[model samples]
Target: MRRWAMQAGLCLALCAGAASAAPAPTWRGLDPDNTLVIDTSQGRIVVEMRPEFAPQSVARVKLLAREGVYDGLLFHRVIDRFVDQTGNPNNRDGGTSSHPNLPPEFDFLLKPDAADAIASRASDGITGFVGATPFSASQLPRPDGTLRAAGAYCAGVVGMGREEDPGTGNSEIFFMREPSRRLDRSYSVWGRVVQGLDVVRTVAIGEPPAHPDRMIKVRVMADLPATERPKLEVMNPRSAAFAALIRKVRAAKGADFSICDIDVPSRSQP
Candidate 1:
């Protein structure tokens, strides 16, 4: 019994020492420079833009949001267990937007350094974070020996909605409720919902509800009163803690794991 107690005590001491050696988790704060807040009847949905992935689309979204074009817009089409569409001032299919039609910006080629930092590897592609934004990428080796990559369409992906003519997308956007791999590299994915997704899930159901729920307001966090702006932080995907999390998740899911299965955990200040 004394030997067993000694063994237990030693194990506890070792664990305490190991815990002290481990760095405390660090969280990166939200950059209002590219953050947006969508106010709705349900609640507020926060989005973080990834201009590096889709510069033109991100520019257009920021332009429209600054002009207040997204305010008072209705979620015209919300398919159950799928994506929800909005961002049209006219609130109808095929209606014109105040902004000019933006050319398609499907994906971007990552810089060489960006390619080397890839974290999660899957049969489909590699996943990593550019800042706090989680992205899955398909890499291609260039003739010059450099690598190029395109973004993946995972859950919470903010994609520009276009008509039959793909280049016609201007002011319409859709939020993915699930991973729609079919749309990856085919649509202009510009940003992702980083907070308040529960509000997105609660968006009123409708192919077009008789009285559809509307956006109460939409503002760039940078444009809001300083004190009114949301304070949010996301887990650093490049951190040792994040790598450990991925390993634990992979161990649990085994071959079934996909990059979309992991979310960069986040918290918003009250």
Candidate 2:
């Protein structure tokens, strides 16, 4: 009995030590100069914002997150095999941030090679590129028989979330509808779902009742007390293969591929 108790005590002590050593959650690939961490009740959603990419949009989101404006919100929109959209703080109708909406920041004439080179160079620390860039469907070449650029304006397919009226994205945000290949070059992908995807998947939908799933609260890691502070790590820029692939696509077509175009590899548990 004494031996068993000793072993149990030792295990508990080791577990506590391990917990203390665990790294805190953080936004990856974030520029220390400007970044925001969105802490939801479900888990932490880190955002490495690019004010240079979309200044007004990033500012709005940062302001909302910082002011505790998104607390007690819900997911609101969750489609199976698609994305889960949120940012409605009120939980009544769709919620907008404290500030007024701005006009759209659409730049449809980005050159593919130029964009690729810029991204590659930026990742190499050669230059500083912040904020998200805009894209248009007409830039992507069709893969089918036509082999021409598809001229569709599917906004929110790849860039920062905003309404059609440009500068309309307030507190509300949406995830990808799917692995959208068509959106590869036309939208700014600010961040991705790193954890709690299952929570997103499990959110209750709305229709007849019109309640939809909601976020209980949204907090920023920086806002939390030091005892509850999260650890952060920056993601390395695209791998060589990824960078080369972008170059190849840009050469064949006339647009750069969005991060959504890449497949996420599966990881094994330790």
Candidate 3:
């Protein structure tokens, strides 16, 4: 049985009632432009894209969304504790897109004080949000004692899965279901699941789910019909409010704090 089904069964056994209502919305630092609304069979999953860190990947996702390439695709590959991947028109192995393949954007320089906010003792690196997307950074000091950093991978991150060639990532994207620090330098980190994480956790698990879930519809928030569009607010990682949240979380977790522990806050409205 799928993890989601098992969990749902557990909920039914324990609660003996309908699922509880969702929490009230808490609007924070809103990024209206970069959000993507994905309606899947399970539920709606909202992703906030980061062009600053992975401009090409963001551009590719936007283009695919606008062109309607992602609609009706299966969550072809989903492993319980690792990731759930899709966006292959050929199902799992044979899909291709008219869009050109992109070179890897594995690492980039940190913008401003992002370095100070998510100082990661777990990986000897740093982690923080650029817009609503959470990222970790690996660094080594130069001869002049200046540190150069690259993005790190954590849970909720959406990354490109590639073939043998590092530059072949065109349309295959996956959601990180758990923290796989080993992928930090390998895959290109592009966006994050800001809302509907519970839905993500329920995706059918298998290399190919026996009954795979599909993305019913995918839209860039900008492209949605005006009345149908969702208003989303995500805490700006670079803001004082987010800084305070980070401090509070660090204090609470202490030695147990990992970048994956933080889920950048976001709220959505129809």
| TM-score leader | 1
Candidates ranked by TM-score, best first? 1, 3, 2
lDDT of 2 by residue, 175-264 (tens): 554555454324334444433444544555543125555555555445566565434443222233433444665565545544333322
Candidate 1: global Cα-lDDT?
0.73
Off by over 4 Å in 3: 1-32, 113-116, 119-124, 138-147, 268-270
What ranges in model 1 sit over 4 Å off? Answer: 1-25, 115-119, 122-124, 144-146
lDDT of 3 by residue, 1-270 (tens): 454454344334322211235422234543546778899999998887877778898889888888899999999999887898998888795476898889998876653333324435333544655555666644333333323454556778888878878899899898888778798868888878888877888999987889999998988887777787666666555455666677888889998887677767765543
Residue 53's lDDT in candidate 3: 72
Clashing pairs in 1: none
TM-score per prediction, in order, is 0.84, 0.53, 0.80
Write one digit per residue (lDDT tens) for candidate 1, span 72-118. Answer: 99999987667889988789777767768988787676544443124
Please say which candidate is ahead in TM-score: 2 or 3.
3
RMSD (CA, Å), candidate 1 to true, equals 10.3
**Global Cα lDDT for candidate 2:** 0.43
Residue 26, candidate 3: alpha-carbon lDDT: 32
Between candidates 1 and 2, the lDDT winner: 1
Top lDDT prediction, candidate number: 1
Question: What is the lDDT of every predicted structure here?
Answer: 0.73, 0.43, 0.72
